[model samples]
Target: MGGAGNPDGPTLGGDDVRILLVDDEIDLADVVSLHLEQRRESFSVTTAIGGNDALSTFESTEIDCVVSDYEMPGMDGLALLRELHQRDQSVPFILYTGRGSEEIASEAISAGVTDYLQKRATSDQYAVLANRIENAVARHRSERARQETELRYQNLVEASPHAIFVHRGPNILYANDSVVDLLDIDDRTEIYGTDPLSYVHPDDRDRIDRRMRKAFDERETADWAGWRLRRDDGEIRHVESRGAPVSYDGQPAVQVVLRDVTDQRRREQRLEALNDATRELLTAETPEAVAQVAVEVVESVFDEPFVAIWSYRPETDQLTTLAVTEAATERAAAERNEPRPVDTVGGDLEMDVFAAGEPRVIEGYADHDDAMTEAFETVFMLPLDEHGLLSVASVEPRTFSAAERDLLGILARSVVAAFDRLAA
Candidate 1:
């Protein structure tokens, strides 16, 4: 038999404490194990005849605490304590024996024994041992739980995509990898212990400071707001940030999460500009006016200013250049003197997309056509529903993103509506 089992079965709700009871006398070990189990429903005691047997049981089982006799054959309580600590230094070990003295207590204390209890004839001594076991086990479990929680938090902070930084008052305490990348810095230590507001744009510093102060004073979460961050290279980046009160190094601090929103904010502004252009398109009196508005809108919305619009005359079957941005005119100055015919077999990508009634993105346009200039690398050819074709070219080879294509579609439809209104 292993030892005395709890008469009421294993303790419910994971409160079971597996205690290893070791003694040279098998009968005394069994009696002590039975008393511990009988005293607490959560205690399930296992007996070992000697130190070697206790070590074997400890290695095989998940023991929370070890209670061993001071005097035993082969290995005494102190030796067993050393052996058990070698395996798990944190596991609680108690020295319980009848031969107890001040010298033995001091030696056990020096040996890192959790508790030393003197054995007595009265059964009341078991109650004292049971209390010490529970107290030591409780402390051990709590420490393990705390360590696990810290490990999980550390992993989560490092893996987060958003730039996270903790600061107490004006001093930055910690920054994650994303923060280092966002600031365009090679090392995170460069910003640690530095004032976080030093990176904020001068125009946004006062406003952000007020929000941070309110969050820290009230210990409340600060709402998300847009702020301009000046990177180490002196480039301004737009970000949306929110702050929540947290404890860092046992002191109150604020954890701020910054999401890079520079691209998103630019897209929103471009959409707003397009909306304004749509109003202008509706007021145009002719197809040429519509083409003029379309070219202007494309030039303003895209980073590439090389945009042009051509009006298709079905009767003459000719493509007439109605409008072109200043950048496009400068880039195609030589071609402006001699325009290519739409009926040509080659080097007429714009006419091909217009006739096909579909939009096309052509990369390396310079390579595709002998007539095309090397100044333009990529071109977006979009049809304006038989009214005309619109072309936007860039010096860099790039395909328009889906959102960019959607904006172009909106502009094209608005131009078509203007043409229909003029025809009516």
Candidate 2:
């Protein structure tokens, strides 16, 4: 048997291994415990005279492995094995006995013993027992670490807010809760094993496919790219996503995280269109020209059909409509029998916003008792400094988001700058 003197003997180094040695023969147990400790400097051995003392010691101390004799006074090694397993099923237990036979070895295996060794007169037997103890302890620690790592990964994936999915080849392997909600699906099972590219817009599929291929084939991370996602109901949503090569269930796959950017993209497009309109506003030489640019910008960028601009007249204490969109004209055509008054402005809402030089958004404008409110449900009144007021109204109820309001403010300032240039 390979002992401490053998160069290739089993050796373990790191944290100390706590071992509980149990035998009715006190001298035999002490000698075996001493030999094990001398063979491996990392081993710390504790001795117990019988099964009852072994149980008491096990409960008090954190023992990594147990090396016990077969026969004892009240509780035998097999009886102690059952009690120890009830507390911790994974702890390593080895049966080292003098009366070893096929009957005892078979019985120890049935009781879930980690290892079995027959006692011998030779002193070298302790070295072999030490090697078995080291192997069992190493395996136990590795398995525990793996279970902890998997538990943490599961918790992180479930708590993430962004849509995450793993795909191998063309089939989806895993998808989180956010993915189901993003696709507008009632169940996640519907997405599993299905092609991920089927949900992508027709125009964007080829580009997304290329990016995913690069990620998997090159084993590199794909940079974020914007794409249109077509939902189950045929609604289109704008999303940005990044992908990286990952190992899923022992196979190479790609894990992608998708973030919804529909609202952000729409705001960016509106700002770009507004910037173009600002260039047009700079060319206007008169207030009426400035109002035309404002009307067109509001109609096109905001998708609001009913838009009107009013010029303030201090001498008459009134606001007269200087420019209106085609939709606005069509809306008022049914009520306009005679030439409207030059001072005929909108209701008190417009007058208040103009007088205060502040913007106001009125939802349910159709409920107001005003001539212009008859056909519109929402109205956004923005004052162009002291020059005039710009109003964009919708037929359906609408509430402008804070970002939309900021964009509208930028439009108002552009018009004010144009008016200042005209005055100069």
Off by over 4 Å in 1: 1-14, 23-35, 68-90, 95-125, 146-219, 229-237, 241-263, 282-293, 329-346, 369-371, 418-424
Q: Which stretches of candidate 2 lie over 4 Å from their true place?
A: 1-13, 20-32, 47-58, 66-128, 147-199, 213-218, 231-233, 245-259, 280-293, 304-307, 320-344, 362-378, 393-399, 417-424
lDDT of 1 by residue, 110-163 (tens): 999988899999968877788888888887887787678757766898999999
**Candidate 2, residue 411: lDDT:** 94
Candidates' lDDT values, in order? 0.83, 0.86
Sliding window of 10 residues with minimal summed lDDT for model 1: 1-10
Q: How far is candidate 1 from the true structure (C-alpha RMSD, Å)?
A: 6.1
Q: What is the lDDT of residue 326 in candidate 2?
A: 77
Best by TM-score: 1
- State the weakest 10-residue window (summed lDDT) of model 2: 334-343
